[model samples]
Each structure stands twice: as structure tokens, then as C-alpha cells.
Target: MMNSRDFHRSPSFTERLSGLSTAFKMFPFIQTGQRILQPFLEKFGFSVQEVTDSVKLFLTNGHPALTFPFLRPPNNILIGCANLLGSKSAPLQFSPQISQFLNESVGKDVVYVSFGPYVKMSGVSWYSQLVEILTELDLRVIVKVDKEFEKEFPKSVLPLNWAPQKDLLRSGKIKLFISHCGNNGKMETIYYNVPVLCIPQFADQPVNAELVKVKGFGESLMKEDISVRAKEVIAAMIANHGTYHRNMKRASDIVENEPGNARENLLYYVEQVAEMGNVDYLVNKVARQQSTVEMYNLDIVVPVVVIVIVVVGFILYVLLKFCVYFSRKVGMAGFRKLKNE
Candidate 1:
């Protein structure tokens, strides 16, 4: 799992197999995590089974179009919750430098770059190469950087302590987004129909980056390969800008034009849960209620398996004995004939 976490290229057969093996290995740890959280979960009158059951409805801020098509979600999973917290937020107020950059640059000639809060750019090995590439690009760049790295960028690039990321993505000025591919950031880019160049660092970021590429909304950059591959990728994205925009627009429409509103869906489910007091019936209670032995039917299976093995062994033993006895009888008859002669 760790091996595949930062893979920038398409996964190979070995990597896919490793992922499968990792998934199998993850269940026990997931169960252990559930057990560890049992004490806190019990306070809410929920058990490990109830928390882990498939019947339990999951409300995510993800849209169906943004998610991989191969994923088969259960009926209880209510996706496309992108705007559950209301569609819009307070308008973003950009700094004087940022505003000036946006005003001066032609529409779709500006790029917004951010790695979210957790990842520090200073520690990244390809940071210098990234800065150089951004500087050389004809497009105007707005980068959210740590204060220490602010002086590293040239005056041509606008380096700020922070920027209104989601608002900027929504704004018509941003031509491309250079992001860490965090879930919220990825969702925002998808929602706004903004093409992205993913520079995923860790966690689910790489997977999200891969999905972006697979969906044809954008491409991804590896930490190690950023120096070597960044320019080529950025050039390709620039050349194929319209195609990316169209792909993203289609995805955005899917998320936006879905039949029901996410806020309404959330409210309806909440009301149902409140009225019912217990949503256990929604899940497969029989499977959850079963003991480990009963779940796998080891009680019945183990005995049957053992009995079959023993019975086969006994039959083989009896056949061996009969063969020995028959051979001895033939030998005695031959010996008597020889003595008589």
C-alpha cells in the first residue's frame, strides 16, 4: 500500500495485485480500529457492527461524476452532496497584488497553485524546479507559499501567504489549477469545471490525482519526476486546454444537474433517522449479529471436512489390508503346490 501511494504512472498488474493484497490485509486493522473506537461509539448507543454495516447511510460531499465509475456503491450511500452546505460562500477578497495580476492577465492565462495547509513546500525536493517552471511559463501564476519561501519566487509570480482557493477556482479568471489533489480541493475544481495539474504528496491525494487524469479533467505530477516531467505536462495541458475544460464542464454538469438537491437529501435522511431513533433495520442485521464461527459456518464446515478426510483414510486402509491378505493366500497356495510336486 505504501509502495503504491505515490505512484504517478498508470498502475501495473503487480501494483494492482499488491493493492488487492493490501485491501485484504486492511480489514483486520479496520476491525481493530473499530474496536479501539468502541468506547466512544458506545456513548452514542452504536456498536461496531452498526457503525460498519452496509445498511447505514453514508453522506459524503462527493459527486457521482467525480468518483470512479468502477466503484459500486450501496443503496444507502448518498453521493453528490457537493452543495449540502449551501451553493455559495461569502465572496473572496483578494489582495492588491492578486487583484492586479488577475486584471492584467488575459482570461484563461492565469494559474492558481496551492498545496493545501499540511504540506510544507520547503521540504519538497522539486520545489526549486517547480518555482523555475512557474516562472518560465508565459501564464501569470498565483502561488500560496510559506512565508520563508516567498522571496524565492520572482516578481512575475504572485506568492501569497494564503488565497481563497475554492472561490478562486469558481472565479472565471483561473485558467488552470496546480493543486495537492486533496479531496475538498479536487471536488471544488470539479465543481467549478477548472482543469488541474495535480502534484499529490500523500494520503488519498495520489489516488485523487490519478482519478483526475483518468477522467480526462487533468494530469498528475510525481514529487520525484516534477523536475523532469513538469514542463512537458504543463505544455500538454496548455495545448489541450479546451478538451480539459470540456471534460470538466461535463463532470460539473453531472454533479450540478442531478435530479435532487444534496441539502434536501441530507435533511430527509436526518429526519428519517430522528423519527426512527434506530436505523438498524436499514442494514443487514443478520450478518452483523452473527458470531465469527457462525459467520463463516466453521462449526458445520470443520466437522464435515474432518469427517470426509477420516472416512477416505479408513477406506484406503481397508483396501490395503485386503490386498495384503489376498497376496498371502496366493503365496501359500503356490508353496503347497511346489511341496506336493
Candidate 2:
């Protein structure tokens, strides 16, 4: 996820042009430790170009045509737009339990708290304290998790194991959403024009949360600061009195009512690709075409890996040999002592 400056605003010519390169694709990203060694693979003469050609196609899950048109360029990225249907449809139903919780919260103003379906509240004290503050402010709370809590919670709070998030956010009583700032949750908030209070939980969450603030849809607080800052942020947004609400509504209309909205463009591309028989000609390139140095580098990497393995094996061997030698000496000494006794 890019900042609004990179999303709605045009990128510099360099960034746009760099989009054509594979290195640029991972530029906004950091490789996890497992993949951190990937740069060394490049030193082995492995071509990222070949890897790029091997992966047939890539697609995004957002409706970029209307939501973020700047994504239209760089040709490789396309919007699959999974949320379009949910946005265009009615609220969802997860289970009787969540439905009943909604029933119990009829007249109260709710600040729905969910860090996506997969994320959960890891801090019991912080969460419990946040609940106290919200209820004291006369705002009800909904904490969505994947499992039931054994502890009895206050009447002002609803700890639902699961929820039809789109439906719940659209419900008239919802005043604010406390979310993980995941893309799907962000889209739902946008769909319903629900103001958000983002407590992003890593990955692209921080970026999405920043967008929520940047676009004036809501505020954000780090999870670490939630204990001290959650009440402050929540109060500010709930009291927004129409700023976040109005801005979000305007954003919703912009994404949905805009000409050539994402849904249509997404379908057009799908049909076009389908008509093309799912062929990606780029993947058809010859793998053997390479420079002498690039090809020889594979041989170089083989020895490097093998030499490391050999060194490790030799160290283990010496350690084992020492253990055996010492054991033999101790055994002999013990046997001699026993005989003398």
C-alpha cells in the first residue's frame, strides 16, 4: 500500500518507469528472513527476469479503476476487485450468536473493533481498559474475535467470535470502527462510509491505516500505545460530529459512482484474458539463453554451498572424535581404579 501521494497523485517519471523492472516490484517491501537470502541467489547468476517470466500473471484484489486509478499504469497490476460485490450488496450473516449480539445492542452507539478476522486482541488488560473507557463515554463496543472468551464481559461490550463485518458496519447504530486496517476491512469501511480507528497489526496494515488518516476517514493509534491513546483517538473520531462521516461518504461515492468504476473494468479485463486463452507469452522464453558468466556462476554457487557444508561436517566430526577419545580414557581409568579397590 502506498501513501495517498503515491496513490491518487502521479508518481515521478522514474518510479513509473522503474515499475517495468522486477527490482522495483519489491522496492516498497522488505523480504522476510527466509527470503532475505534471495539476494544471494541473484549472486548465483539466477535471473530475476527468468523468475518474473515464470510467474504467469499477478492481480490485485481491489477495484483499482475507480478506487485507485494510478494503479492502471505499470501494466502488470490489475484490480480483481473482490469487495465490489459485498459493497454493492446487502449485509452478511455469520451466525446466530453474532446476530443475537446485534439484537442486544439496539439503541446503543457502537464502535466496532476488529483487527480483521484473523487478528485478535493479544493484550487482555489493554482491551479491558479500552472497553471501560468507551462504555463510560456512553458508547457501546463490539470486539470481533474468532473464538469465545470465558470471562464475563460488561453489558456495554459485545465480544463476538465472528461477524458479518460488512453488514454490521452498515447497520445504522455503528458510529466508528476500530480495525487492523487490513485492505478488506478498509474497503468495507469505505463501502459503508464508516469512520475508522486503525490499530494496524503489521504487514500492509500500517500503510492502510495511514491512508485512513490521510484521506480524513479516521485516526490511527499503534497497538503499543492503545492503552494510553485508544480512548483519546476513539473519543475524537466518535465526536467527529460529521467530518469523518462526510469525507468517507464522499469517498464511497467517488469509488462507486465514478465513471468506468472498478467492477466494469475488472470484468472487461477478465473477459479479455479469458478470450486470450490464458496464454502469457512472456513465460515462453528460452531458459538456456544466458551469458557465460551468468551460467558459470551457478557452478560457483554450488561449491560455495558445498564448502560450507563440508566445513560444518568437519567441525562436528572433530567434536565427536574428541568425545570418543575422552570417554575411552575415562573408561580405562575407572577400570584400573576398580581393579585396585
**Whole-model Cα lDDT per candidate?**
0.71, 0.65
lDDT of 2 by residue, 1-341 (tens): 21223344333434434443433343343233225435765888765545554555555555442233332223244443345544546646557766676678777677888766665565556666666778888887887755644556777777877766777877656888887888788877876878888877666677667667767888888868976777777877777838988887776776667667666766765776789865354232222354443323433446767999999999999999999999999999999999999
TM-score leader: 1
Instruction: Single out the weakest 10-residue window by summed lDDT for candidate 1.
Output: 1-10
lDDT per residue (tens digit) for residues 1-341 in model 1: 22323323333435444445445544454454456668878999988766766346667656667765432223244555345234445576777777787887765478888899766776555766676786687768888787667446666678777897867887778888999998888888877778999987766677778779988989998878887889888878888889989998887776666667566677777887899865554444343455666534455557768999999999999999999999999999999999999
RMSD of each: 13.0, 15.5
Instruction: lDDT for model 1, please.
Output: 0.71
Prediction 2 TM-score vs. true: 0.62
lDDT of 2: 0.65
